[model samples]
Target: MIARSTFSNGIVLCCRSDDDDSLLAVKCIDIDECPTSSLVLLQHEVALTRTISHENIHTYSSVWLSKSRLCMSSLFMDYGSCADIISSHFKHGLPEKIMALILYEILTALSYLRSVNLIHRGVRCSHILVSKNGEIKLSGHRNMIELSRDGIPVKKVHDFPKHDSSMLPWLSPEILQQDMQGYCTKSDIYSLGITACELANGYAPFTDMPSTQMLLEKLNGTIPFMLDETTVAPLIEDTSPSANADTEKFKSEMIEAAKSRKFSTAMHQLVTDCLERDPDMRMDADQLLKHPVFRQIKGLSKCQILQPVFEKMDPISKKASARVFQEQEEMMDELNRMSMCDVEWDFQE
Candidate 1:
């Protein structure tokens, strides 16, 4: 283990394996002695992780109560979140093809969740994880809720419960209008559309406004384009100004430029379907998985495309490395002095 931290109700420890030195993280939530909401959420998360074994969903290797702390260990994602990439790089937005692949992976995981009648209440850039292998795992399942067999929530989740208001941008209009109650799995579709927009434009629309105003706009506002619709530069192939090339020819050039844009017509339509204001009008996860945007996805992994981006952000200073080495040596010496230390003898110097 390299580092640890304590939060209001929990602790997190960062660990590396002895063999590969690969990263792992364990979250330990303290629930005191009561049967509180924190304990209920922890149990639900562990149970869902155990049952949902999809590749795009994070799996917990172990869960145990360690001295009043519910500790759950899982793989550590290396490259950071989509939100992180946007805030650092690609501020204007990512290319359409990359967004397509990302949305496809999320929809795949959501499809599995739907099969079990689960609704991932939160879907946003921060919750999407990217790894070196191009794998996309969905985290932030603390708000996930189960529905009846007919796809309806048995209990009114929001009648008495409070939700994070920061998630307003990614939530659906229907839920916001109804005071965040009586929503179903279809609500996820709306958030996915907003998330797609966030990935395309580097931020969700109307984020500068207060959450209440944003919700009002969603209820009675014009639909916004999910992708930035800037025209591509006109091609110079057959552009010798001719005597008879008039306004008609100029219009044709503009049309061709629009056609050359990267965001596909099908992708625009898919976003519209997803963002339909009517709850029943939105496409389900199954239909979303079959959208034409996914057809344009290339088979390359996430790491192949994002490794350069990660490297650009990972310039460690020599001074920092030296300090880290010094700390490592001190830790090693301390461990050596302690009789309880049971470190592997084959560790490289």
Candidate 2:
């Protein structure tokens, strides 16, 4: 191994392989000597990542399992998560232009996933990885499903493992029922809306709610979207999802909550389109990508969009990338703490 760092969780080590001062590969290890469920999940992640590729998606190169540990090698990402930037640099929100570009990049990836009939079951702000080059990409393939060949996502809520419970706030109403409905790309569109809110306000709408309450809120369409106080609140967050809070204060509080990163009407509109309660009503990735907010990015190269984000990262991103070699799990924790950033984490090529 070129470099390695192990975690106390079931996950073992994650490292960057380097050659001639450029990234060669990213290796992930899962220590499951007892043949556990987590081992299967790790293997699934490896296979899924290896199968999918887009300029904005992390790429897996190879995978193999030893007697006890499962190892996966993929492209390295120097930027950690957009959460790091929100926590550190834009606690209130991100600029409309940057958020627009980032969402555009993600939709590009999502469009590719849809073409293959896949549902990125989990698409949250925390899963969005960035690089110092300002390139934004998505990770967390742990819960994805290939609907093309598989027919439908795993049935029964029991089939979903506990580790992914944190993602409930992003699940669509149809998927939250006791009798699960077939989750498709539209389900992901709902998540993309929540992620947009998280991107705008630095936290998901229901972060403080208990897990069960969050589930009910999502099921009943009670959650809000892009409710930042400083920026223009999307009209839909008020109308569509059944409102549970004092709409006046919910509106006033967000208006009062520190609005550090003001965005635009086009970005807000994009979030509204994705947040449409009816799965049938939601815009697919391809449709949302065509919205006007993304028009600002039409002629620009991916690198051009990323350059500003790279320049905006704080020093914490550099330290976190380095520390990933010392404590992979801790580094992950740091990403949530809003203390890290990433540089061009792609392979040398």
- Candidate with top lDDT is 1
Top candidate, metric TM-score: 2
Q: Which run of 10 residues does model 1 get worst, by summed lDDT?
A: 227-236
State every prediction's TM-score relative to the real structure. Answer: 0.72, 0.73
lDDT of 1 by residue, 1-349 (tens): 3223322266555666676786666777666843576567667767766877888887788888878777778777655578877778666567676788788889988898888777887788888977666778888776677776356646334421243566777887777777655667788888898888788766686675787688788898435565333533332344645556564464454445345456778778878888888776778999888887777666766666556565656421233356678999999999889884565576678
> For residues 230-347, could you state the per-residue lDDT of candidate 2 as single tens digits?
4445532445542556655454455556343345667778887887877777889988877988888777776676665567664433564666567977777787887336444667
Residue 114 in candidate 1, Cα distance off native in Å: 1.0
Model 2 regions lying over 4 Å from their true place:
1-21, 24-27, 33-35, 65-68, 148-163, 178-180, 228-262, 301-308, 312-349
Clashing pairs in 1: 134-302, 134-303
